[model samples]
Target chain A: MRKLSKVITIFVMVFLSVALSFAQGSGDKLGDQSKLIKTLNKPLTFVFIPKVIHPWYDVVKEGALAAAEEFKKMGITVNIKFDAPTNADISEQMKKIEANISARPDGLAIAALDPATNTRLINDAIKAKLNVITFDTDAPNSNRPLYVGHSKDFQDGYDLGEYLAKLINYKGKVGILSGSLTAPNHVGRVKGFKEAIAKYPGISIVFDRPDNDDLQKAVELTENALQANSDLVGIFGCNASNPIGAARAVKAAGKTGKVHIVGMDDLPETLQLIKEGVIDATKAQRQWEIGYWAVKYLVAMNQNHTIPAVHETGSRLITKNDL
Target chain B: MKKFIKTKEMSMFIALAILCLIMTVSTSTFMTPYNIGIIARQISFIAIVAIGQTIVLLTGGIDLSVGSIAGLSGILCSLLMTKMHVDTLSIIFISLVLGIILGCVNGILIGRLKLNAFIVTLAMGEIYGGLILVITRGYPILDLPESFAFLGQGMIGLVPVPVIFMLVITVVIAYILENTPFGRNIYAVGGNSVAAKLAGIKVENVTLYVYMLSGMFASFSGLLLTSRMNAGQPTIGSSWVMPSVTAAIIGGTSLSGGEGTIIGTIIGAAFMGVLANGIVLLNISSYWERVITGAVVIIAVVIDLLRKIRSQKE
Candidate 1:
């Protein structure tokens, strides 16, 4: 019984330690460089809140956190609070926004899960006299001071179309493993994909499977699509997970030579898959740039400085050859 | 009540038969051996978990943590094999054991403390999910050996290992549910917990064992999935919860507890798998799959409800 008690106690302690450890992050002494950033016109605090605690946000978080320290000497205090909800809940995010507002930060850097769900909260934050800048997923028309992420969703989408068109030499039946049709970003990319493919007379979108932004579902859906259409020319994943799914499914189905695939985002898995000749190419979204620009935009907004109203972090087309 | 209860379980079988007839006429590929293999492999994970879950449901409990436990164990196994330099088989075995431990935890709180199983498993699910993120730092372990990969990708005489796992688990669970005294105890406990206590059933032990079994099944899927991907991502099994629950319910397992079957759940999973396979074979969009799945789940339940009503009227 004593041994049981001892073991239980150890388990609890270990579990707590692991949970608490994540909350710490790399909070290292940014104070060392705080003075160099003291040139700010006023004391400002910018907060970057993510939709979830997934590894995808790690780069963006580092950007905002580092920028906070960089601009701290200029009387800027970047308060990075990212205790995102359990499953990327939009309602929980709104509550967090309220809490951030309660903290009365000067500027906010947030990547919205659903623009429609969070628009009112962001608008309310704007009315509360806080500066808002979107990163990754944007909430446009929310009266944010500026947008500071990817320049054009079209470029990302077009890259896949262009790469695949060139691969099949623009002459075959290609399919699209599209993402959530309702998501504006996904919708915009598909539009761009269609526009790009239209330039190639022979390349037609015979099959477009909008996969609701799930990888395994994409795989299953893509697998069946491939089986149904063995004579298909190529495939384009309209989202990050979509491409990875397409690639994996294509590989699993042993259709590597039959279909050329590409998609957007540089998810590590996607990158490795590209290296493995699964994905033909992926349009890289520089996460560090999104973070860097979000902080830069927030810092500028807090100081009442007018920079370019629109900022694009720029994108790179990555292919197997590049890898 | 007994007649109504029996019909709810068989409704999906009817649905499956109807879908097969329609699919055979509509798509030539639907009846192929390869497609059948794909269909079996596709539903194996859900089938495996649902079989175990049906047992738990028979004892008047629910386990919301199965998906989380699968994901957690998958990442844990990969991390053990890759980062900690543990032997691959040992890592897989330990991960499965951890899943059982998680289930046991759920059983202890729900059975011994007499807390609501729904609330306890839900909270435990969240806790298990958090541990997954914390342990992996949100990155997949990419370097699983070729043998592990082969386990996920390889097949024995055209049958995927996962499907075999599903079939084996189903048979074992069927034996336990039908041939064992514990099986009898399950229906008794779920039929009426108060009576079960008076009739000398070890209620807590049964409850605990059922959940542990659920975890073990989930762990099997997790290991298979990690091997298939040759990596372990934190989000590996997020889409599994609904399918697992739907399979159990559609298989004629009563959510209210006291009656269910392992074979029935397996068939239900295969039925759902065929539907998903049909959708893909026909080239339906992936996003629509969700809407369709939700609709199918609702229709299955409604049909089950109707079957019960008809039997009751009889």
Candidate 2:
């Protein structure tokens, strides 16, 4: 009986070792990998990555979540994954991208930080025959097959510029506050915004303050810009967080009523400011559609549904009327 | 000639001039008072933190917790003002002292306990960041007193209050770094711990004070930010870590310890702020701003390297 017990212990150890090695081998085989063949015999799975897990993405999350629920009954098992590089570093994001590809999901929806940075990853993902699309941010040069967000970042900027221009009745020495000047999306918007403002004739972006996505810097920049451009009659914040910082500075300077203010995103402060008439209106993009289409295409491609190369998500001009 | 020619200070000064020139030419609006004021005021936050970072960097160490500390304290002070019904005047004082305490803990762990400065501060940053989020749940504390807000937004005549704060801070810190006995001891400890210990300077105390000072500066930036926004936000200090390092590095300060200047860091901070502002003012797309920024950072480092090479040759 003792000899039999010893034999059982040795057998259990051998089984555990074999299982561990098998698990290890599988993990290394597909680390964040998206491969269509992996789902050929199983339920289809897809992962959607945003710029970061911001409250703004909550809307996108809802849209994707809803779609996943609908597709579950169709025998397509979709898994939603998320990651945020503490900062925008291409190499840092590449690690997550590599892991996603290695995991060998059926599809991937990405919002890359920069086109230049993701060039190599785009090459690898395409070579491996994985389905990919962009939402919110796009890698235009990369062969990602489809871009599901705004057709172009410049259009989004144009939309913002048009909204502010018409609201101010196309006349004012206006200042622009932005988060980062280097972001392709923001850059596109700036170009479009500048062109759109030219149509206004009287409206000019007197001072352009780039806060590097830092809210504190945003406030300081706005305050200085206001001081330097005392002739400024309006302010248009170019990103989600800039409006509050700009508005706060404007309010502090006792110029709330004297200057027209317009900004982006519906942060509680921006919403409050709009409600209180501190800011005229805000411009919101269809983040819900971005996430929805990104995930939908990812899942469909897994099921062998070949879709279009680019899916343009339009921006919504959210004035007090819409809110 | 060699000693004077290849100085880190000279290298950083040159980089600052080049960046100024590039931006000045690229954007017609870049050199205006409005833009200059924005850059100078904007740099104050990072410059303050960099002063502390410089101290840590001088000791051949780093502090990742400064950003978290700023966020955490910003939330705390804002909450106190808005929720606890505490007086804003008292709240600012509490935040400043809290900064010192936080820095002291970092100093103790690294200086006294002999822990790895990077790991200790990194973990502390996480712990503090989580604590801030856990307490506030990722929202800004609003409805701060105007008097409190005034400290951040109020200008004393033509100068921004924050820039004034920066100037005052740099002057005092510079004085200590160059003159005070305690300051001299700090240099000794940073230069060589064993040698300093043998020379009878209390190395542990000096190290402790430097980190504590770093925390205080971060807290000051947080308080100023709080006033600037008239709210306390948990996410306010998210990207501060890099700029603090960037300012210190570009200012001719070595990451390996033993040399630096508060003024140089202030200039570096201003340089970063100006570069970003110039790109936007030139009507460049916001997205391309990052490309320009990344390019500027690389250039600053390269310029520093060339200066080092030149100094070596001289």
Candidate 3:
């Protein structure tokens, strides 16, 4: 048994090292082309790191690839390397950023999962002579220049809040289903929603539930809010899965079409709910544009150190009509 | 009845009853039929998974990969149903077989090959979980057939279908544990493997079967959850591992092995479900839920240790 376990451990170590070396080799291959323009003599390589591997990030990858294609058309030979942890983890993101930096890419783009832990890493990468840009999530305290990302999450939430209020005729009790309270983006959205709802004196935020980004918890929170508040006319979800969960809750409560729901993000389930009229609307982040512009900005920064410090990629509000 | 009250399982039941009473008194919504139905349905998933964990625990082993098996089976079942146009029942049958196969891998590795159960299942979990992401690409499979939802979302009169499923499983497992020779051998193997081997029991086979059952139960839960959500979500089973283990431990299943009851695990899962419901009903901050849950689990473990020491003295 001991010998078998030893063999297994050895096999796993060999597999991991092989995978790691492949990751490094692929990153280096992008810059190996010898023939290029005088100004862009060496093939420029940039690594785009997201918080995790999700459908949202897949769309972002598409945008980055599109930008890479455009750069290639311009004879600049821009190689955009994309990688993320299999799951959403801050430490994993940190490790990936460190690995990317060691690969000696011309530039690096990352969506920081936590500003405090990642800011120092971003600064270290800058010190290592890697031009760093952040998209989707920004670390303003870091020395990295240029943030090509979304509009204020607060505005996204405020718009959903105001839109939900109008959908319910501006006079009803509403509940806010949010993700983790400590998450900065979720908090900002909730703040904006609260501020927006305060304008209409008739609209009151009666219930505040944080689901920790679990679909089950989100559903339970929404259901409990409904059971507690019999007169709840609307629910505003400040995270991607919240609206889908709220829609399920509303349907289970037999309050479909009666209870209004607006959530953030364009998850497939959320879109299906909107088409079914279970959800009134959803705030769709411009993930593609965020990715496209981040790569473009990184390339421009590598070519000439003259790029804007901040760029805002706006969001869209999707309704049943859009479906 | 007096003897029942003195047993650890009864204490767990009392804990559940006390928690429910507190919730009912604190919030009018807690006693409502809607809230009760939702809680019952929610408890069903964890309860089913915990049964598998309890059996594995009883056999002096752990299966951390149950959650990943759940996720893999759900995604695979959904894909078979929607993409290949297979009927729902067949898809479920296929998932059960797949679960057994996946569990057999762990069984062979740990039971036959004598690898450490903890490390073997943990490695298997990562592999299965990784497969889930690769299959779905982090997107949910949203094209489930309408008929499939009946397993999870349907109601038999006032009780939800999932709750019914939970009850049926509990009864079957309870009967097997109390009435079957195979079940008795499982306890024997867990109690002392060398002694059981000396007594002509096939310890390796018992270990393999328990893990296979665990895998089967976990996959059953995966299918139910996928049906309830009306999609095959890659995130379906990530949060289940701890809760299932917690349910087993809280129900008086000793981690060292050879002692547990299905009834006790049912109450343990119910206790957890009620606690979460109470937190929501009382308008308590959700941020405190995890902290409270961890503290309560620790308290349960301490109490279990105390009971063991007292029983030893007796």
Top-lDDT structure, candidate number: 3
lDDT of 1 at B154: 72
**Cα lDDT, all candidates:** 0.75, 0.74, 0.83
Cα RMSD, each candidate: 26.1, 24.0, 25.7
Please, what are the lDDT tens digits per residue for candidate 3 over residues A168-283? 88898999887865467888899899999999999888898778677899999988898999998999888888888999999999999889999888988888899899999988
Q: Model 1: runs farther than 4 Å from truth?
A: A1-323, B1-11
Native contact fraction (fnat) of model 3:
0.00
Best-matching candidate per DockQ: 2
TM-score of predicted structure 1? 0.51
Ranking by lDDT: 3, 1, 2
Task: Assess each model's interface with DockQ, reporting 2 decimals per model.
Answer: 0.02, 0.03, 0.02
lDDT of 2 by residue, A268-314 (tens): 77888877677877777777887787778776676666788888777
Fnat, one value per model: 0.00, 0.02, 0.00
Candidate 2 wrong stretches, greater than 4 Å: A1-323, B1-6, B285-298, B309-314
Encode model 1's per-residue lDDT on B1-314: one tens digit a residue. 65533654455666688898898888765677656765676678678778777888888888888888888988888877777777766776887788789788988898789899899988998999888867865455666766676566579998988888777877887897888898999999999988999998899988988889888878778788777555676666656777788888777788888867887788788887777666544544333555787887777778767876876898
* Model 3 misplaced regions, further than 4 Å: A1-323
Candidate 3 docking band:
incorrect
State the displacement of the C-alpha of residue B55, model 1, in Å, after optimal TM-score superposition.
1.5
For residue A275, model 2's alpha carbon misses the true position, in angstroms, by: 41
